[model samples]
Target: MTTESDVAYAHQPGGLLKGKVAVITGVGAAGTIGAVTAAIFVQEGARVLAADISGAQKETALSLGPAAAPFQVDITREEDVEAMFAHAVETFGRVDILVNVAGNPGGRRGPEVTVEEFESLTSVHLLGTLLTNKHAVRVMAPAGGGAIVNFSSAASFNIDERISMAYSAAKSGVNSLTKSVAVLHGAQGIRANAVAPGFTLSKKNHRVPPEAMKELGGKAALGRPGQPEEQAHVAAFLTSDRASFVTGVVVPVDGGWSARLA
Candidate 1:
Protein backbone atom coordinates (compact mmCIF):
# COMPACT_ATOMS: atom_id res chain seq x y z
CA MET A 1 0.00 0.00 0.00
CA THR A 2 3.01 2.31 0.27
CA THR A 3 3.31 4.08 -3.04
CA GLU A 4 6.49 5.86 -4.16
CA SER A 5 4.82 9.16 -3.51
CA ASP A 6 4.19 8.22 0.10
CA VAL A 7 7.95 8.15 0.76
CA ALA A 8 9.16 10.57 -1.86
CA TYR A 9 11.61 13.38 -1.11
CA ALA A 10 13.24 15.92 -3.38
CA HIS A 11 16.71 14.53 -3.85
CA GLN A 12 19.17 14.33 -6.72
CA PRO A 13 21.59 11.66 -5.58
CA GLY A 14 25.20 12.26 -6.49
CA GLY A 15 26.48 9.29 -4.49
CA LEU A 16 26.91 11.15 -1.29
CA LEU A 17 27.22 7.83 0.51
CA LYS A 18 28.61 5.76 -2.28
CA GLY A 19 30.17 2.33 -1.72
CA LYS A 20 29.22 2.28 1.95
CA VAL A 21 27.25 -0.21 3.98
CA ALA A 22 24.92 1.27 6.60
CA VAL A 23 22.72 -0.12 9.35
CA ILE A 24 19.77 2.08 10.22
CA THR A 25 17.48 1.32 13.15
CA GLY A 26 13.78 2.26 13.55
CA VAL A 27 13.07 1.71 9.88
CA GLY A 28 9.82 -0.22 10.17
CA ALA A 29 7.08 2.26 9.29
CA ALA A 30 6.67 3.67 5.80
CA GLY A 31 6.26 7.32 6.71
CA THR A 32 8.90 7.44 9.43
CA ILE A 33 12.24 9.23 9.36
CA GLY A 34 14.05 5.91 9.53
CA ALA A 35 12.31 4.45 6.50
CA VAL A 36 12.80 7.64 4.52
CA THR A 37 16.46 7.71 5.56
CA ALA A 38 16.87 4.18 4.26
CA ALA A 39 15.37 5.13 0.92
CA ILE A 40 17.63 8.13 0.65
CA PHE A 41 20.70 6.14 1.62
CA VAL A 42 19.94 3.64 -1.12
CA GLN A 43 19.48 6.43 -3.62
CA GLU A 44 22.89 7.74 -2.59
CA GLY A 45 24.39 4.35 -3.45
CA ALA A 46 24.83 2.90 0.03
CA ARG A 47 23.61 -0.61 0.71
CA VAL A 48 21.52 -0.53 3.86
CA LEU A 49 20.23 -2.90 6.50
CA ALA A 50 16.86 -1.44 7.48
CA ALA A 51 16.29 -2.64 11.04
CA ASP A 52 13.46 -2.24 13.55
CA ILE A 53 11.57 -4.02 16.29
CA SER A 54 8.63 -4.42 13.89
CA GLY A 55 8.24 -7.02 11.20
CA ALA A 56 6.98 -4.27 8.93
CA GLN A 57 10.60 -3.32 8.31
CA LYS A 58 10.88 -6.33 6.01
CA GLU A 59 8.41 -4.80 3.64
CA THR A 60 9.82 -1.35 4.19
CA ALA A 61 13.27 -2.47 3.17
CA LEU A 62 11.98 -4.37 0.18
CA SER A 63 10.36 -1.19 -1.06
CA LEU A 64 13.78 0.51 -1.18
CA GLY A 65 15.02 -1.99 -3.79
CA PRO A 66 17.64 -4.75 -3.68
CA ALA A 67 20.20 -2.58 -1.92
CA ALA A 68 18.21 -2.75 1.30
CA ALA A 69 17.55 -5.67 3.65
CA PRO A 70 15.46 -5.74 6.82
CA PHE A 71 16.32 -7.11 10.24
CA GLN A 72 14.17 -7.28 13.36
CA VAL A 73 15.98 -6.10 16.47
CA ASP A 74 15.27 -4.83 19.95
CA ILE A 75 18.09 -2.32 20.28
CA THR A 76 17.87 -2.40 24.05
CA ARG A 77 18.99 -5.99 24.08
CA GLU A 78 22.71 -6.74 23.75
CA GLU A 79 22.11 -10.02 21.96
CA ASP A 80 19.75 -8.43 19.51
CA VAL A 81 22.06 -5.49 18.90
CA GLU A 82 24.96 -7.81 18.29
CA ALA A 83 22.99 -9.89 15.85
CA MET A 84 21.85 -6.76 14.08
CA PHE A 85 25.40 -5.65 13.32
CA ALA A 86 26.40 -9.21 12.55
CA HIS A 87 23.62 -9.52 10.06
CA ALA A 88 24.66 -6.25 8.51
CA VAL A 89 28.20 -7.47 8.13
CA GLU A 90 27.09 -10.81 6.76
CA THR A 91 24.74 -9.19 4.30
CA PHE A 92 26.72 -6.16 3.19
CA GLY A 93 30.32 -7.21 4.00
CA ARG A 94 31.03 -4.30 6.38
CA VAL A 95 29.44 -1.51 8.37
CA ASP A 96 30.60 1.90 7.24
CA ILE A 97 27.77 3.81 8.89
CA LEU A 98 25.26 3.39 11.70
CA VAL A 99 22.18 5.55 12.24
CA ASN A 100 20.39 4.74 15.51
CA VAL A 101 16.86 6.05 15.14
CA ALA A 102 14.90 3.54 17.21
CA GLY A 103 13.31 5.18 20.24
CA ASN A 104 10.06 5.50 22.23
CA PRO A 105 8.33 8.72 23.17
CA GLY A 106 8.12 9.90 26.79
CA GLY A 107 5.52 12.27 28.21
CA ARG A 108 4.98 11.52 31.88
CA ARG A 109 6.49 14.15 34.21
CA GLY A 110 6.52 15.37 37.80
CA PRO A 111 6.01 13.09 40.78
CA GLU A 112 3.41 11.19 38.80
CA VAL A 113 6.15 9.71 36.61
CA THR A 114 6.69 6.17 37.78
CA VAL A 115 10.06 4.49 38.24
CA GLU A 116 9.13 1.95 35.57
CA GLU A 117 8.43 4.70 33.11
CA PHE A 118 11.83 6.30 33.66
CA GLU A 119 13.57 2.97 33.27
CA SER A 120 11.69 2.15 30.09
CA LEU A 121 12.54 5.41 28.38
CA THR A 122 16.18 5.36 29.46
CA SER A 123 16.58 1.74 28.46
CA VAL A 124 15.28 2.40 24.98
CA HIS A 125 16.85 5.76 24.32
CA LEU A 126 19.98 5.98 26.44
CA LEU A 127 20.86 2.37 26.96
CA GLY A 128 19.95 1.57 23.39
CA THR A 129 22.32 4.25 22.15
CA LEU A 130 25.06 2.93 24.38
CA LEU A 131 24.66 -0.63 23.13
CA THR A 132 24.52 0.32 19.47
CA ASN A 133 27.48 2.65 19.71
CA LYS A 134 29.49 0.06 21.60
CA HIS A 135 28.97 -2.58 18.93
CA ALA A 136 29.37 -0.14 16.09
CA VAL A 137 32.76 0.86 17.44
CA ARG A 138 33.69 -2.80 17.53
CA VAL A 139 32.95 -3.05 13.82
CA MET A 140 34.21 0.34 12.72
CA ALA A 141 37.47 0.31 14.63
CA PRO A 142 38.44 -3.02 13.18
CA ALA A 143 37.45 -1.93 9.71
CA GLY A 144 39.62 1.24 9.88
CA GLY A 145 36.81 3.63 10.80
CA GLY A 146 33.18 4.55 10.03
CA ALA A 147 30.47 7.09 10.80
CA ILE A 148 27.63 6.96 13.36
CA VAL A 149 24.52 9.09 13.60
CA ASN A 150 22.55 8.77 16.84
CA PHE A 151 19.09 10.36 16.99
CA SER A 152 18.73 12.72 19.92
CA SER A 153 15.87 15.20 20.38
CA ALA A 154 15.25 18.91 20.77
CA ALA A 155 14.01 18.03 24.27
CA SER A 156 17.63 17.47 25.25
CA PHE A 157 18.51 21.10 24.59
CA ASN A 158 15.37 22.89 25.81
CA ILE A 159 12.77 22.68 28.55
CA ASP A 160 9.51 21.66 26.86
CA GLU A 161 6.41 20.70 28.84
CA ARG A 162 5.52 18.30 26.04
CA ILE A 163 8.66 16.26 26.80
CA SER A 164 9.29 14.14 29.88
CA MET A 165 12.19 14.52 32.27
CA ALA A 166 13.25 10.97 31.51
CA TYR A 167 13.35 11.59 27.76
CA SER A 168 15.31 14.78 28.15
CA ALA A 169 17.78 13.17 30.52
CA ALA A 170 18.25 10.17 28.25
CA LYS A 171 18.93 12.35 25.23
CA SER A 172 21.36 14.42 27.26
CA GLY A 173 23.12 11.19 28.00
CA VAL A 174 23.15 10.47 24.28
CA ASN A 175 24.96 13.74 23.65
CA SER A 176 27.59 12.82 26.19
CA LEU A 177 27.92 9.29 24.89
CA THR A 178 28.33 10.57 21.36
CA LYS A 179 31.08 12.93 22.45
CA SER A 180 32.78 10.14 24.31
CA VAL A 181 32.81 7.97 21.22
CA ALA A 182 34.29 10.74 19.13
CA VAL A 183 36.99 11.55 21.65
CA LEU A 184 37.86 7.92 22.23
CA HIS A 185 37.72 6.75 18.63
CA GLY A 186 38.53 9.71 16.42
CA ALA A 187 42.11 8.59 16.17
CA GLN A 188 40.82 5.28 14.91
CA GLY A 189 39.10 7.14 12.08
CA ILE A 190 35.58 6.81 13.54
CA ARG A 191 33.25 9.80 13.48
CA ALA A 192 30.15 9.95 15.69
CA ASN A 193 27.50 12.68 15.77
CA ALA A 194 23.84 13.14 16.71
CA VAL A 195 20.75 14.81 15.28
CA ALA A 196 18.23 16.55 17.51
CA PRO A 197 14.93 17.08 15.75
CA GLY A 198 12.04 19.29 16.78
CA PHE A 199 8.33 18.63 16.24
CA THR A 200 8.04 16.60 13.08
CA LEU A 201 4.96 15.51 11.16
CA SER A 202 5.96 11.89 11.16
CA LYS A 203 3.33 9.16 11.20
CA LYS A 204 3.39 9.13 14.98
CA ASN A 205 2.46 12.80 15.17
CA HIS A 206 -0.43 12.38 12.72
CA ARG A 207 -2.65 11.30 15.61
CA VAL A 208 -2.62 14.84 17.00
CA PRO A 209 -5.42 17.11 15.81
CA PRO A 210 -4.42 19.50 13.05
CA GLU A 211 -5.02 22.56 15.21
CA ALA A 212 -2.99 21.18 18.08
CA MET A 213 -0.24 20.08 15.74
CA LYS A 214 -0.17 23.51 14.15
CA GLU A 215 0.13 25.15 17.55
CA LEU A 216 2.96 22.84 18.53
CA GLY A 217 4.78 23.46 15.28
CA GLY A 218 4.26 27.20 15.64
CA LYS A 219 6.71 27.11 18.54
CA ALA A 220 9.47 26.86 15.96
CA ALA A 221 10.78 30.04 14.39
CA LEU A 222 10.18 28.50 10.99
CA GLY A 223 6.44 28.46 11.81
CA ARG A 224 6.19 24.83 10.75
CA PRO A 225 6.97 21.31 11.80
CA GLY A 226 9.83 19.45 10.12
CA GLN A 227 9.42 16.62 7.65
CA PRO A 228 11.05 13.20 7.94
CA GLU A 229 13.03 13.84 4.80
CA GLU A 230 14.37 17.06 6.23
CA GLN A 231 15.93 15.15 9.10
CA ALA A 232 17.05 12.32 6.79
CA HIS A 233 18.96 14.69 4.58
CA VAL A 234 21.06 15.88 7.50
CA ALA A 235 21.76 12.36 8.66
CA ALA A 236 23.00 11.50 5.19
CA PHE A 237 25.30 14.51 5.17
CA LEU A 238 26.77 13.66 8.56
CA THR A 239 27.22 10.04 7.60
CA SER A 240 28.81 10.87 4.28
CA ASP A 241 32.47 11.68 3.78
CA ARG A 242 31.53 15.28 2.99
CA ALA A 243 31.38 15.71 6.76
CA SER A 244 34.78 14.18 7.31
CA PHE A 245 35.79 16.80 9.83
CA VAL A 246 32.44 16.94 11.64
CA THR A 247 32.30 14.71 14.68
CA GLY A 248 31.13 14.74 18.29
CA VAL A 249 28.54 17.38 17.43
CA VAL A 250 24.78 17.38 17.97
CA VAL A 251 23.19 19.04 14.97
CA PRO A 252 19.69 20.43 15.55
CA VAL A 253 17.36 19.88 12.64
CA ASP A 254 14.64 21.77 14.48
CA GLY A 255 13.75 24.56 12.02
CA GLY A 256 15.34 27.17 14.29
CA TRP A 257 13.25 26.00 17.22
CA SER A 258 16.30 25.67 19.44
CA ALA A 259 17.41 29.11 18.33
CA ARG A 260 13.97 30.41 19.28
CA LEU A 261 14.42 28.86 22.71
CA ALA A 262 17.81 30.56 23.00
Candidate 2:
Protein backbone atom coordinates (compact mmCIF):
# COMPACT_ATOMS: atom_id res chain seq x y z
CA MET A 1 0.00 0.00 0.00
CA THR A 2 1.16 3.54 -0.75
CA THR A 3 1.74 5.72 2.28
CA GLU A 4 1.44 9.47 2.65
CA SER A 5 5.17 9.77 3.25
CA ASP A 6 5.82 7.98 -0.03
CA VAL A 7 4.24 10.84 -1.95
CA ALA A 8 6.77 13.16 -3.56
CA TYR A 9 6.42 16.85 -4.34
CA ALA A 10 9.08 17.47 -6.99
CA HIS A 11 7.97 20.81 -8.28
CA GLN A 12 10.76 23.38 -8.26
CA PRO A 13 9.77 26.81 -7.03
CA GLY A 14 9.97 29.71 -9.46
CA GLY A 15 8.50 32.35 -7.17
CA LEU A 16 5.18 32.42 -9.03
CA LEU A 17 3.41 33.79 -5.99
CA LYS A 18 6.34 35.66 -4.44
CA GLY A 19 5.42 37.64 -1.34
CA LYS A 20 1.71 36.87 -1.59
CA VAL A 21 -0.49 35.74 1.31
CA ALA A 22 -3.05 32.97 0.86
CA VAL A 23 -5.82 31.43 2.95
CA ILE A 24 -6.41 27.80 1.92
CA THR A 25 -9.25 25.75 3.44
CA GLY A 26 -9.44 21.98 3.90
CA VAL A 27 -5.84 21.53 4.92
CA GLY A 28 -6.08 18.79 7.53
CA ALA A 29 -4.35 15.61 6.45
CA ALA A 30 -0.70 15.37 5.47
CA GLY A 31 -0.96 14.07 1.92
CA THR A 32 -4.32 15.42 0.95
CA ILE A 33 -4.81 17.96 -1.84
CA GLY A 34 -5.30 20.81 0.61
CA ALA A 35 -2.06 20.10 2.39
CA VAL A 36 -0.19 19.61 -0.83
CA THR A 37 -1.60 22.91 -2.11
CA ALA A 38 -0.43 24.62 1.05
CA ALA A 39 3.06 23.24 0.54
CA ILE A 40 3.06 24.34 -3.08
CA PHE A 41 1.86 27.81 -2.12
CA VAL A 42 4.71 28.16 0.31
CA GLN A 43 7.14 26.73 -2.24
CA GLU A 44 6.02 29.32 -4.77
CA GLY A 45 6.88 32.12 -2.34
CA ALA A 46 3.57 32.72 -0.63
CA ARG A 47 2.67 32.72 3.05
CA VAL A 48 -0.23 30.36 3.74
CA LEU A 49 -2.78 30.03 6.52
CA ALA A 50 -3.85 26.39 6.36
CA ALA A 51 -7.40 26.25 7.70
CA ASP A 52 -9.43 23.13 8.42
CA ILE A 53 -11.96 21.87 10.93
CA SER A 54 -9.54 19.17 12.02
CA GLY A 55 -7.03 19.74 14.79
CA ALA A 56 -4.46 17.98 12.64
CA GLN A 57 -4.22 21.24 10.72
CA LYS A 58 -1.70 22.50 13.28
CA GLU A 59 0.79 19.78 12.51
CA THR A 60 0.07 19.88 8.81
CA ALA A 61 0.84 23.58 8.69
CA LEU A 62 3.96 23.15 10.78
CA SER A 63 5.24 20.54 8.34
CA LEU A 64 5.19 23.19 5.65
CA GLY A 65 7.69 25.35 7.57
CA PRO A 66 7.53 28.93 8.84
CA ALA A 67 5.75 30.38 5.82
CA ALA A 68 2.62 28.45 6.83
CA ALA A 69 0.32 28.67 9.86
CA PRO A 70 -2.74 26.67 10.92
CA PHE A 71 -6.24 27.91 11.69
CA GLN A 72 -9.11 25.70 12.79
CA VAL A 73 -12.35 26.60 11.09
CA ASP A 74 -15.72 25.09 10.31
CA ILE A 75 -16.64 26.61 6.98
CA THR A 76 -20.34 25.87 7.51
CA ARG A 77 -20.42 28.38 10.35
CA GLU A 78 -20.46 32.09 9.54
CA GLU A 79 -18.67 33.01 12.73
CA ASP A 80 -15.89 30.53 12.11
CA VAL A 81 -15.52 31.73 8.53
CA GLU A 82 -15.28 35.33 9.69
CA ALA A 83 -12.74 34.51 12.35
CA MET A 84 -10.71 32.55 9.81
CA PHE A 85 -10.14 35.56 7.58
CA ALA A 86 -9.45 37.77 10.55
CA HIS A 87 -6.85 35.34 11.75
CA ALA A 88 -5.25 35.24 8.32
CA VAL A 89 -4.98 39.00 8.23
CA GLU A 90 -3.43 39.07 11.68
CA THR A 91 -0.92 36.41 10.73
CA PHE A 92 -0.03 37.36 7.17
CA GLY A 93 -1.02 41.03 7.19
CA ARG A 94 -3.05 40.66 3.96
CA VAL A 95 -4.89 38.07 1.90
CA ASP A 96 -4.21 37.71 -1.81
CA ILE A 97 -5.64 34.30 -2.53
CA LEU A 98 -8.45 32.09 -1.24
CA VAL A 99 -8.69 28.43 -2.22
CA ASN A 100 -11.70 26.44 -0.96
CA VAL A 101 -10.77 22.78 -1.18
CA ALA A 102 -12.73 21.47 1.78
CA GLY A 103 -15.53 19.01 0.92
CA ASN A 104 -17.22 15.75 1.90
CA PRO A 105 -17.75 12.81 -0.41
CA GLY A 106 -21.31 11.81 -1.30
CA GLY A 107 -22.14 8.13 -1.48
CA ARG A 108 -25.94 8.16 -1.57
CA ARG A 109 -27.77 7.89 -4.88
CA GLY A 110 -30.83 9.93 -5.78
CA PRO A 111 -33.35 7.58 -4.22
CA GLU A 112 -31.08 6.78 -1.29
CA VAL A 113 -30.44 10.42 -0.50
CA THR A 114 -32.42 12.01 2.34
CA VAL A 115 -33.31 15.62 3.10
CA GLU A 116 -30.58 15.70 5.71
CA GLU A 117 -28.03 14.34 3.25
CA PHE A 118 -29.00 16.93 0.65
CA GLU A 119 -28.82 19.77 3.13
CA SER A 120 -25.51 18.54 4.48
CA LEU A 121 -23.93 18.39 1.05
CA THR A 122 -25.26 21.80 0.06
CA SER A 123 -24.27 23.33 3.36
CA VAL A 124 -20.67 22.27 3.08
CA HIS A 125 -20.06 22.71 -0.63
CA LEU A 126 -22.38 25.51 -1.72
CA LEU A 127 -23.01 27.46 1.45
CA GLY A 128 -19.41 27.09 2.53
CA THR A 129 -18.16 28.48 -0.77
CA LEU A 130 -20.49 31.45 -0.44
CA LEU A 131 -19.29 32.27 3.05
CA THR A 132 -15.61 31.99 2.19
CA ASN A 133 -15.95 34.07 -0.95
CA LYS A 134 -17.98 36.66 0.88
CA HIS A 135 -15.33 37.15 3.53
CA ALA A 136 -12.50 36.82 1.04
CA VAL A 137 -14.04 39.59 -1.05
CA ARG A 138 -14.33 41.76 2.01
CA VAL A 139 -10.56 41.55 2.44
CA MET A 140 -9.56 41.40 -1.22
CA ALA A 141 -11.80 44.25 -2.39
CA PRO A 142 -10.23 46.79 -0.11
CA ALA A 143 -6.72 45.50 -0.83
CA GLY A 144 -7.41 46.44 -4.46
CA GLY A 145 -7.55 42.80 -5.70
CA GLY A 146 -7.35 39.07 -4.90
CA ALA A 147 -7.89 35.64 -6.42
CA ILE A 148 -10.36 32.93 -5.39
CA VAL A 149 -10.38 29.29 -6.45
CA ASN A 150 -13.33 27.10 -5.45
CA PHE A 151 -13.33 23.33 -5.89
CA SER A 152 -15.90 21.72 -8.15
CA SER A 153 -15.99 18.13 -9.40
CA ALA A 154 -16.30 16.25 -12.68
CA ALA A 155 -19.49 14.82 -11.18
CA SER A 156 -20.93 18.28 -11.62
CA PHE A 157 -21.14 17.68 -15.38
CA ASN A 158 -20.76 13.91 -15.83
CA ILE A 159 -23.00 11.24 -14.38
CA ASP A 160 -21.28 8.57 -12.31
CA GLU A 161 -22.88 5.73 -10.42
CA ARG A 162 -20.41 6.31 -7.60
CA ILE A 163 -21.43 9.94 -7.12
CA SER A 164 -24.52 11.08 -5.25
CA MET A 165 -27.13 13.38 -6.79
CA ALA A 166 -26.83 15.85 -3.94
CA TYR A 167 -23.08 16.17 -4.46
CA SER A 168 -23.52 16.94 -8.13
CA ALA A 169 -26.19 19.52 -7.45
CA ALA A 170 -24.09 21.19 -4.80
CA LYS A 171 -21.05 21.35 -7.05
CA SER A 172 -23.20 22.83 -9.81
CA GLY A 173 -24.27 25.49 -7.35
CA VAL A 174 -20.59 26.18 -6.64
CA ASN A 175 -19.96 26.88 -10.33
CA SER A 176 -22.77 29.41 -10.47
CA LEU A 177 -21.60 31.02 -7.25
CA THR A 178 -18.09 31.27 -8.68
CA LYS A 179 -19.37 33.09 -11.74
CA SER A 180 -21.50 35.45 -9.71
CA VAL A 181 -18.53 36.38 -7.58
CA ALA A 182 -16.42 37.01 -10.66
CA VAL A 183 -19.04 39.25 -12.26
CA LEU A 184 -19.69 41.28 -9.14
CA HIS A 185 -16.13 41.50 -7.89
CA GLY A 186 -14.17 41.59 -11.13
CA ALA A 187 -14.22 45.36 -11.17
CA GLN A 188 -12.54 45.39 -7.82
CA GLY A 189 -9.68 43.27 -9.19
CA ILE A 190 -11.01 40.21 -7.38
CA ARG A 191 -10.81 37.16 -9.66
CA ALA A 192 -13.01 34.16 -8.90
CA ASN A 193 -12.66 30.79 -10.66
CA ALA A 194 -13.37 27.12 -10.02
CA VAL A 195 -11.37 23.96 -10.58
CA ALA A 196 -13.35 20.83 -11.49
CA PRO A 197 -11.12 17.83 -10.75
CA GLY A 198 -11.90 14.25 -11.82
CA PHE A 199 -10.72 10.93 -10.43
CA THR A 200 -7.90 12.29 -8.34
CA LEU A 201 -5.99 9.99 -5.96
CA SER A 202 -6.25 12.00 -2.82
CA LYS A 203 -5.58 10.62 0.67
CA LYS A 204 -9.09 9.19 0.95
CA ASN A 205 -8.62 7.11 -2.21
CA HIS A 206 -5.27 5.59 -1.25
CA ARG A 207 -7.09 2.59 0.18
CA VAL A 208 -8.74 1.83 -3.15
CA PRO A 209 -7.42 -1.30 -4.79
CA PRO A 210 -4.98 -0.84 -7.64
CA GLU A 211 -7.21 -2.84 -9.99
CA ALA A 212 -10.20 -0.74 -9.11
CA MET A 213 -8.19 2.43 -9.48
CA LYS A 214 -6.95 1.37 -12.90
CA GLU A 215 -10.47 0.55 -14.04
CA LEU A 216 -11.79 3.92 -12.96
CA GLY A 217 -8.74 5.88 -14.10
CA GLY A 218 -8.76 4.12 -17.47
CA LYS A 219 -12.10 5.76 -18.22
CA ALA A 220 -10.29 9.05 -18.51
CA ALA A 221 -8.47 10.00 -21.70
CA LEU A 222 -5.20 10.05 -19.77
CA GLY A 223 -5.77 6.49 -18.66
CA ARG A 224 -4.63 7.35 -15.13
CA PRO A 225 -5.78 8.95 -11.93
CA GLY A 226 -4.51 12.46 -11.17
CA GLN A 227 -2.32 13.34 -8.21
CA PRO A 228 -3.07 16.05 -5.66
CA GLU A 229 0.07 17.90 -6.75
CA GLU A 230 -1.16 18.00 -10.35
CA GLN A 231 -4.30 19.74 -9.20
CA ALA A 232 -2.29 21.94 -6.83
CA HIS A 233 -0.02 23.13 -9.60
CA VAL A 234 -2.96 24.48 -11.55
CA ALA A 235 -4.39 26.14 -8.46
CA ALA A 236 -1.09 27.82 -7.75
CA PHE A 237 -0.97 29.22 -11.25
CA LEU A 238 -4.57 30.43 -11.16
CA THR A 239 -3.85 32.42 -8.01
CA SER A 240 -0.62 33.87 -9.31
CA ASP A 241 -0.17 36.94 -11.47
CA ARG A 242 0.51 34.63 -14.41
CA ALA A 243 -3.25 34.15 -14.67
CA SER A 244 -3.98 37.84 -14.39
CA PHE A 245 -6.28 37.69 -17.39
CA VAL A 246 -8.04 34.50 -16.26
CA THR A 247 -11.22 34.67 -14.22
CA GLY A 248 -14.87 33.56 -13.99
CA VAL A 249 -14.19 30.22 -15.70
CA VAL A 250 -14.23 26.67 -14.34
CA VAL A 251 -11.10 24.85 -15.43
CA PRO A 252 -11.31 21.05 -15.44
CA VAL A 253 -8.16 19.49 -14.00
CA ASP A 254 -9.56 16.08 -14.88
CA GLY A 255 -6.96 14.84 -17.35
CA GLY A 256 -9.65 14.85 -20.03
CA TRP A 257 -12.06 12.66 -18.08
CA SER A 258 -14.90 15.11 -18.65
CA ALA A 259 -13.94 15.44 -22.31
CA ARG A 260 -14.47 11.78 -23.17
CA LEU A 261 -17.82 11.05 -24.78
CA ALA A 262 -17.69 7.32 -24.23
lDDT of 1 at 252: 92
Task: Provide the overall lDDT of each model, using Cα atoms, as 2-decimal numbers.
Answer: 0.90, 0.90
lDDT of 1 at 198: 92
What TM-scores do the predictions have? Answer: 0.93, 0.94
Report the lDDT tens digits of candidate 2 across residue range 88-164. Answer: 99998999999999998887897999999999999999999999999999998988889999999988887887789
What residue pairs clash in candidate 2, if any at all? none
Worst window of 10 by summed lDDT in candidate 2: 1-10
Which residue pairs clash in candidate 1?
A: none
Regions more than 4 Å wrong, model 2:
1-13
